[model samples]
Target chain A: MCELMALSANVPTDIRFSFSGLCPRGGVTGPHRDGFGICFYEHGGLREFKDYLPSCQSAIAEFLKSYAIRSKTILSHIRQANVGGVSLENTHPFQRELWGKVWTFAHNGQMPIEQVPQPSYYQPVGTTDSEKIFCWILSELRSAFNADVCISQVSAYLHSLCNRLNALGINNILLSDGDAIFAFCSTKLHWVARKAPFGEAQLRDCDLSIDFASVNSDDHVSVVIATEPLTKNEQWLAMKSGEGRMFVNGESSWHDFGPEIIHKKSEPTKIAS
Target chain B: MCELMALSANVPTDIRFSFSGLCPRGGVTGPHRDGFGICFYEHGGLREFKDYLPSCQSAIAEFLKSYAIRSKTILSHIRQANVGGVSLENTHPFQRELWGKVWTFAHNGQMPIEQVPQPSYYQPVGTTDSEKIFCWILSELRSAFNADVCISQVSAYLHSLCNRLNALGINNILLSDGDAIFAFCSTKLHWVARKAPFGEAQLRDCDLSIDFASVNSDDHVSVVIATEPLTKNEQWLAMKSGEGRMFVNGESSWHDFGPEIIHKKSEPTKIAS
Candidate 1:
């Protein structure tokens, strides 16, 4: 299994605080040490950095920790190498250009190799089942939607596709196209939104803490989603199994359980300090 | 106008020496300070780094200078924007995947925006004429070939496409797909090959010199191409106007001029120390 994390904000926001909480899991605090990757979407452009070294030991990751690159949408992953070899090409957060926008996808769990469908337009450059599934989703989206179709119109359709993959195995995923973050939880995923009257939050993986009041203004709002909660003081809303949600401008705008599967909504899990 | 550099080698080679010679031109020695980017091909995978800051001032470029990443094929560009804004999306060495192989392109000259053809499949994410031309070429190639077609078999076709763009304006280009480096010279481009018995070479823009004999093995062979001669002691072969060439495994494998124009080949320019 792997770990996935994403951020969406009303304004450009630095990701260092949340990222610091997750980086330790790649090798020091957890066993997901195969590789690491992150994609930042800024001004309709994407910056991607990937390394085959463990995140805790990678120089690239170290530089990113110190570099204050502000972005509104971001997606990151740490791999454990279940379906592919440890390689630069097998790193998570694979990206492709669709309808003039850059689309990035990262997976957290395994899907049966035999059950994955063949892609027609987009092709996988790596041997990972994750990349193949990403390509398949893009290929299908290209066939079903035109360039003029709004991305929001395809949310339910995307949920339907994610539902099919969830049936095979664990299908936790994070996807984005510069505008919003689309999350699908088959096994595990949690999210926290911070706005006015923010308080201090302590890292769960490390001994670092950040006071949100000092860094954020009253109007600033941001939502962070991860495979596991990164902070102990914040109340992270855990998504129920087989659920899809779209986060836009620091808020959840749309959500749906696949038409085929009716899942009872679960209560939010609060991590006590 | 911008600066272009590329390398084709028989084995994986570190590009710091050549890159060091080109870095100064981005801001310190010349005026191409808009942005910089480089792409390295290693083990059938690609690593790309791009920054909006000038090469001389960018922390990312500084890290790359010392990182010592080795690869068999490399393409780099430092830009002086003409038709596009200085942003991450407008950075050179743009990349896209075709036929399950990552294709990268970097251009050093300008083309008339109105003359660029609209692409059908691949689309440009940036507003640069260079990116539009790249997408157009890829769209055309997708139509003319299939996944089964060997990349070498399509080199001649690629040259033809480049020739069309050259007619629109100055179009010096460097393109690679991990197998080889394809160069199209509309005006200025030079190259030199080094092998056994390699001698010392001094940089033209920096106060640094390297004795290749001390660093490289007897079997090492490398070809370096740039918009201008990068070394002060080497004999650089300048490509004729409207000529297309392919450098593979440290040697020029094929070359041709457009069928529409013919001219006498120019003599190699020798630079004295």
Candidate 2:
């Protein structure tokens, strides 16, 4: 298993502070020393930085922390190898082009190696179950929809797919396609939304604090999702098992509970927050 | 105008030395202080490092120069930014996924932006004439052939397209599909192969010397291509106008000179060195 982190914001936001808390887990606070990667989405373009070295000791990771690349959406992961060797090719936060837009995926759990789906359109370049599953999910979406499909409709289909995979084992995942971020929780996933009247937040992994009120405007709304919550002061929402949520514009657009997603009379339950 | 550099090796080779020589030119030796990027092909996967910051001032660039990531092929560029603004999206060496394989492209020189063909499948995420031309070329190839076509046949078609674009402006380009690298020279390009009996080579842009004979095996054949030779001592093969060459396994697989390339010939002029 590995760890996942993601960010979705109404405005372009810096991820350095949150990332600083997570980097230590790669080799210091945790034993996930295989590899790590981070993907940033800006204006329909994707920039990624991946390294085979543990983030705790990686200069690439060090450079990235201070570089402060701002983006509306970001996905990051730290891997502890199970199905693949420690190599750049096997690094996490894999991405592929889909629907004329870049789509990125990161996983934090392991399933049966033999149960990995046979890929069709997108193939895994690295020998990782995470990458293979990512290819499988994207291939399924490619076959189902064209380039201009609605996000909610795509999420509807993806909800089913995420549930099917989660049934096999722990399937905590972070997926994004520039427009929105979809997070599904199987075993461990947490989220926190920072909005108007923001206050200071303290890091749980290290001795650090961020005064969000001094940096962000009142209109700025940001949501961060991770395998484990990075901050201790904030009230992080612990996702229930089999829960899949879709976030757009820094707010929850839809929340579904696997089979328990209440099918209302005319429309599906979409609780806006 | 911009600078381009690429490498294709029979075995995985470190690119730090050549990249170090090219990086300083972005600001110190040259006035191309817009942006820089480097692409590496390793085990069917692509690892790219790009920054909108000038390479001379970029910490990311400095780290990459000493990191010494090894790969079989690489493509890099430092932009002077005539066609587009200096932004992350406008950085050179753009990549797209096609046929389950990642394809990367980098271009030098400028052209009339309006003349760039309308894209079909691939679209330019950044507003640049170079990226527009790359999209056009790939879209043309996507319509022309399927996923698993012969390399020679694909090179033949690409030869015509490269020449067509070259007729418009100085369209020097480096293209790769992980397996082979295609280099086309419209204004200027050069290449050199280092194999058995290799000797010492000194950097042209910096005061760095490398003794390839001590580092590489006798059987290793590596080819380096650039806008101009990176090393001072290398006898670089200066490419002629409209000359397109396909390199596979670190050797010239097919060489074409636009109109001089015969259409009816059953065999191509493949020069093995």
Candidate 3:
């Protein structure tokens, strides 16, 4: 499988320490050596870099080690290659523009690719099922509303889309539009929040630790979500098999993905050979 | 050159529409067809996929058209291979674990491979300077904290390390440890935020437009950052050269990378090629 990492904080913070422990799994301390990428939001836009190289050996990854790009919200990934070929075009953290804002995305599961109705305004660039899914959703949103939909309406639209995605199978995913973070879980997902009573954390894959108290003030609150627990001593809350949650400014905005209906009655559809 | 996309919203929103426009540039609409990868954060962890084919024609990107893996904070990237060989092992969006959190990263620029210091706790699995930089940074954090430093201290320590990295050549980067997003500007970086008075935006590279009023709420604040402006008629802020900034929950926290110091005053100090 693949691994994911994200940060949503009330204040901007650096991720170098945490990344130090997680990157080794990609063909080093572990086995997720397919590819990787990361995204950071700044001044209202997203800045990102991606590569088809293993995180353990990528020059970009090394630069990130010391680069220290900081954002209030961040998303990152390391690939293990279960589906697509390993090429630069297949790297994680894919991006697109809609409604004037840039949207960034990455995924960690394999889905049976299915042919779907193409959207009038959006189309896929790659053959990955993940990008196709994102495009379809955006098209749906554009068609559903004009340039005046309310926030509640937008949320409802997304809620319906999440339901549709879960129906597709193995729909664990993360998305952001530089305002909030939305996390939907079809399988494995976990999260933790660090606030006033912050403590030290230890890495599970590597010999490393950090004391959050030293970097955060009393007003700072931070939350983290990942595919696997990155530390040995921290309590990570695993999402139920089918649960979609939203985090805004380091707080959880719980949105039930609702009951999952397995499509055992329908024949599995395939897209790519 | 590669293209990057991200979303940080108050709710779960699919970037498929925006990404659809960006994907074409991968090879179909533009030129960055080397490879593609994307990661989505669901619940507390991440799910990701990568392909070693051009995003323009890759089945993986095609599948993403309909997949709606949503997150409040998302990061996505498309590659154009500036360094390392074009194999799956060299794709972007690398992931690792540290202090109990998964850290994800990706890069867009090339770095001199010989400038990096050899790492002890983390090491590169690929031959790219990106991965090497990632390992070196992680190792430094591990060494500085020794698995028992406070998180605040860890952040402070990272700030110092980031200062060192900013001194390196052209270090435009994004980083996250699952708490906050960190962004650094070296050469090219631009951003824009969409809020209350949101309006229509058109893609600079494609014939796509989205009226923000239809998809966003007044309460919904978003920020978009990129190496280049993605849209026309929007106020895109150019990051000051050689400066690093951080964003937390759609807000920016500016930090000076400190005074610039020349890496090599002469030739003898430079590592032999």
Candidate 4:
């Protein structure tokens, strides 16, 4: 499979440090080195970079360490190439347009062809099943709502979509439209919130640590979701199988995809810290 | 050339609507179809997807329109071949591992060979100058700090590094490590913030609009930065040439590269917003 990383903050923040730790696993530390990519949402558009090359040796990865691009929501991935070929065209974090805004998507697991249908408003540029699934989701949404519908209504529709995707098997996904982020977990997924009373954080993949207190203001609040735990020191909440969560403005909203096969929900569930 | 999209918010949000508007430009509305990528920083790690084909037709892009991966910080991009070849090896939003964290980066401008030196901790996996520059930056930071530094100190050093990069030329960039976001502008960067009094937003590339207040809570706050204005109804703050800005949590800090060249200190004149 592959690895994933995401950040949702009350303020604009950079994910370079966490990415720095997770990237090694793409090839050196682990085996997810087929390709890697990242995206940052600015006000009106999106900034993204990717490499069909392994994450461990990609120069673009190195540049991010010092570039320091900050945002309220960000997504990143390192692929191991399960279903798609190890070509740039098959890289994750795909983009498409519908109803005017640019939409982005990334996946961590594979699905059977029977799970998805052909898309209407969006189409796949590559042959990856991940891309095909993304297209199917958008087409559903376009047919469901008009261009002027409220996002909340869209969010409810998406919750149902995630449920349908979860039935396809291991549907861990990350998606955005330059405004909010929606995450779903079918297999491996985890998350954490760093806010006031923040403490030190040590990387699980590298020999680095960061003290968030010094750099964060009292009003600053952030939530992170990932495929695996990146830090050894903090508490990373694992998403129960078949669980779907929506993060908006640094807060999380969750829905159960199917409790019959998935694990039970944990107590003391917090939406946004 | 390439286009970037980012969102910084007080809450977790999705960029599907905005991305829906921007993806068409990546070969449909415009010509940035060489490749496309996106990254979303979740609670712990990141989720990224990319395709070497034009985003307009990419299936993955279509899926994102309805995918509910919500986060406060989001980044997305559509590429028009510049320094890299039209292959996956040269995709944007490259990733790597350093100091135990996954680091990601994407660039909008080209860089000279002189800007990058031999790599140490990181190296380029592609032939793109963009990747070379990314690795060089990581090498510099690794050589200077062993990955155990405080976030503030790292931010300070990054500021200096960004200043140096701005001197190179058209260094508009966005970077993250799944923790915070850092942005530097050399030329053609713009941003806007939306909060409690959020209003209607009309897309510049498509005939679509959204009134954020109808979907968001009163406490919600969001900020967006882009290379060009994505909306016709909102006011965008353009970064002065040779300036750098950093966003943490939801707030922003800016610095001028090489001491304000516009007018020597003496009660600096505020440029019209």
Top candidate (DockQ): 1
Between candidates 1 and 2, name the one with more favorable lDDT: 1
Model 3, B131-189: lDDT tens digits are 66677777787677644443333554555565566555445566665445556565567
Give the Cα error of residue B44 in candidate 3, in Å. 31
Residues B19-45 of candidate 1 have per-residue lDDT tens digits of 999999999998999989998888557
Residues A1-273 of candidate 1: C-alpha lDDT, one tens digit per residue: 899999999999999999998899999998889999999988558888888889999999999999988999999999999888898888989998898888999998776565678888998888988998899888999999989755566889888888877766667889888889889998889999999999999999999999999999999999999999999989999998778999998989999865333332242122121
**Residue B163 accuracy (lDDT) in model 3:** 52
B70 Cα displacement, candidate 1 (Å): 0.8
Relative to the unseen true structure, what is the C-alpha lDDT of residue A145 in candidate 4, on a scale of 0 to 100? Answer: 80
Candidate 2 per-residue lDDT over residues A183-245, each given as its tens digit: 988778899999989999999888889999999999999999999999999989998877899
Report the lDDT of model 2 for residue B142. Answer: 82
RMSD, each candidate, Å? 6.1, 6.8, 23.6, 23.5
* DockQ computed for model 3 against the true two-chain complex using alpha carbons: 0.02
What is the lDDT for B82 in model 3?
68
Give the alpha carbon lDDT tens digit for every residue of A73-135 in model 4: 788888988776786556778765445455678888765544566665455645677877888
Q: What is the Cα-based lDDT of residue B144 in candidate 3?
A: 71
Clashes of each: 0, 0, 174, 158
Residue B223 CA error for candidate 1 (Å)? 1.2
Candidate 4 retains true contacts at a fraction of: 0.00
Cα lDDT, model 4, residue A124: 61
Model 2 lDDT, residue A137, Cα: 91
Where does model 3 exceed 4 Å of error? A115-119, A148-153, A261-273, B1-273
* Model 2, span B1-273: residue lDDT tens: 899999889989998889988988999998888989998887446778888889989888988877878899899999999887888778989887676667789999777677777878776767899988888888888888987864445887898888777656667899998888999888789999888898999999999999999899999998989998999998899988789999887888899877432221223233221
Residue-level lDDT of model 4, residues B25-137, one tens digit each, is 99878889988888776644455666777889876677677565677777777888867577655777776545534567777776544554555545465567776767777
